[model samples]
Target: MGTPTPPPSAAKIRRTSSSGGSGSIILEKYQLGRLLGRGSFAKVYLARLLDNPSAPEVAIKVIDKAATVDAAMEPRIVREVSAMRRLHHHSNILTLHEVMATKTKIYLVMELAPGGELFAKLARSRRFSESTARRYFHQLISALRFCHQNGVFHRDIKPQNLLLDQNGLLKITDFGLSALSEQKIDGLVRTACGTPAYTAPEVISRKGYDAEKADAWSCGVLLYVFLVGSLPFDDGNLSNMYRAMHRRAFEFPDFVSKSAKIVIYRLLDPNPNTRLSLDELIKLSWFKKSFSQENLRSQGSDENPTGSEFLDSKQFKFMPRVNAFDLISMSSGLDLSGLFEEETTSSKEIRFTSKMEVAEIEEKVSKAGLEFQYRVERRKGGAMRLVKGRAVVVVEIWGVAPELWLVELRLVDGAAELGESQWGELRLGIGAIMAQ
Candidate 1:
């Protein structure tokens, strides 16, 4: 960890007051402190939960329904919530602690990343050394890998949307532009969204492009920006910039290492099909210098890394009932519950929606070393049972809301063998398999 980067001097951290019953100005549950940040659609404030004074302060996103000019934007807000919730608990992604909506507005309670955007930090230091850039790049890749695993793609992967916590951890924020991997037809998305400079060639082509590869291309641009303090294909003329991006026109300063340049070249490949996949990118000599194959191999083990035994005395909490839209966006990420969901009477489970065919999911699960018995339960709904020694895991995947499959996981093991560490490791394992 390095010196904590200070936030922007112009951040509007003002004290806001609301009406109270006794003519005083104070909100009900949260004490709104300052304006932490803002966007076109909403504003974020630094606030604390009234009941839990000792709890960490949060960044509350205020989205007023009346602020929008059209009724259609509400669905996009819903989509943002759905996308954020689906990515819950990812280390490199911002966490949505709570979602509260009133008739007039929706309030989202989120974890605060006080260190501000990586862009601001870059501005202060001019540019990061290769080691520093490598560290942040690793987090960016990991977060993007997790998103891709869950079938989510952050179409906008710019520095402005990337924030750093006090401890120097990078948190990927702003899901308004995120989309489910299967939302497109034949894995080709028609919309050309994202900042013009960082946009992938295929996306600019408008003929349709793979969202996953588009994300990879953005990552390439990000790494380049991090290492070199400027845009690779930047130009005053929009046509020239677009032309440069399509032709993969970018140069490395003499200071950039050969290994890093190789990774960037593969990532910025004009053809999405030839773009280096996450698995391939991670194995690069330069990138792997930061994170190695040893840790990757260790994540698949059933044992905890720590020597202590895992005591699962507390039952795990199930998520609140979700609307149909959220249920669909989360199907891929929820496969992780088999590793972490605590044991209880009423099925300890996690539910998400998946676009992958049942046959495809089943094939992946089987290849992961688990044996299962697939059963048909009513129309468009089915269940799979897997048993190991005496430990049994039940998975139910049902079709809902047009081709979407609702996936539910239940653990039936009376004796809990895995704890937080083990479960986290298991999530990495499952995520890797799903990314394939």
Candidate 2:
């Protein structure tokens, strides 16, 4: 088979430029610009690939490994890459281009979300019309359906994590707090994660809870916020917040349309068992009218049983639209991935499949100034670690089927946060840095 064709989105890019920080030379491939955003462990920068200006500007997340106060966060940092790689193909999910690393830092190159955070959008608009709100909610539901189908649970779902592209499309970002269904103990996620305001009652209770239900509850909170311009369950005290959520104590403003109220009530249903499913929500008169086939895709209606060439035709108005929702809410909702599901799927675990020689790989690392420490053989492939002033760089290579090879770069300490000079040199030595 020939090389796979990339999505049209891969070709869309924002503006790009470069600036000197501390009078140092910038990386050649990426012309680094201004700082975009920052958190405790990472800082995002606006960067453009020199070879492809037509391609969208990438968001480079520079992760400072040595800055981590807790050793436990290390695993979670690595897990973010695995989670994004699997979830990248969806229209509503963030896209990760590559993850490169040094001994002390890890670099994440991702899609630029020029429209900014959905929260900022909400703040600016104050509130949305019922018609406008329905459009955004339809997109959110589509994203969630995809995650649940793939067995990934975004435990955190709030406006803050939801981003909007220039087209006003929803893009789900942060995965640091998410958990895969397979990782649960006894089909129950025991940890309490997510912002308190958006968290479900069961999740904040500290008792083991269903991941699907917890996320649904959060989604409901977002809907309410989108329509009301404020959170449904806000309070100064933590105890008060939990009390309100447990009892479903919030009230709707007079302006909220009757149809919207119906969906909100069911979405915030205190009982997870009775909460509305994706099918039921789309079937509502409000959704059907505003969220027709033209406006959005249904997670539960992929087969298009009617075989109608015009799925979005208004002619179906009097033809009983119930089947459309029923189809979407099937055992598994409609899939937007279509027959191209293989294009979206990627392995989360690290494995090597490069044709490059091992000796050449070692020579590159040595030439980059990382002092070779030692190498040890494992059952399948050996491992090696290099050091330079308390910084640690780990190299893991393994053999796979049909005589394929792969190499992985892991940043340990001091070296993880590379100076502009070191990062540039290391990139040249790393042979075919592959994304798993």
Judged by TM-score, which candidate is best? 1
Q: Model 1, poorest ten-residue lDDT window?
A: 306-315
Q: Local error of candidate 1 at 335, Å?
A: 26
Q: What is the alpha-carbon lDDT for the whole of candidate 2?
A: 0.58
> What are the lDDT scores of the predictions, listed in order?
0.61, 0.58
Predicted candidate 1, C-alpha RMSD: 13.5
Question: Which runs in model 2 stand beyond 4 Å of their true positions?
Answer: 1-28, 69-71, 297-436
lDDT of 1 by residue, 144-229 (tens): 77676455788899999999877777889888777764366644678777887887877867587888898998999988999989
Which candidate has the highest lDDT of all? Answer: 1
How far off is residue 258 in model 1, in Å?
Answer: 1.0
Model 1 Cα shift for residue 308 (angstroms)? 20
Pairs with backbone N, CA or C atoms under 3 Å apart (clashes), candidate 1: 331-352, 331-353
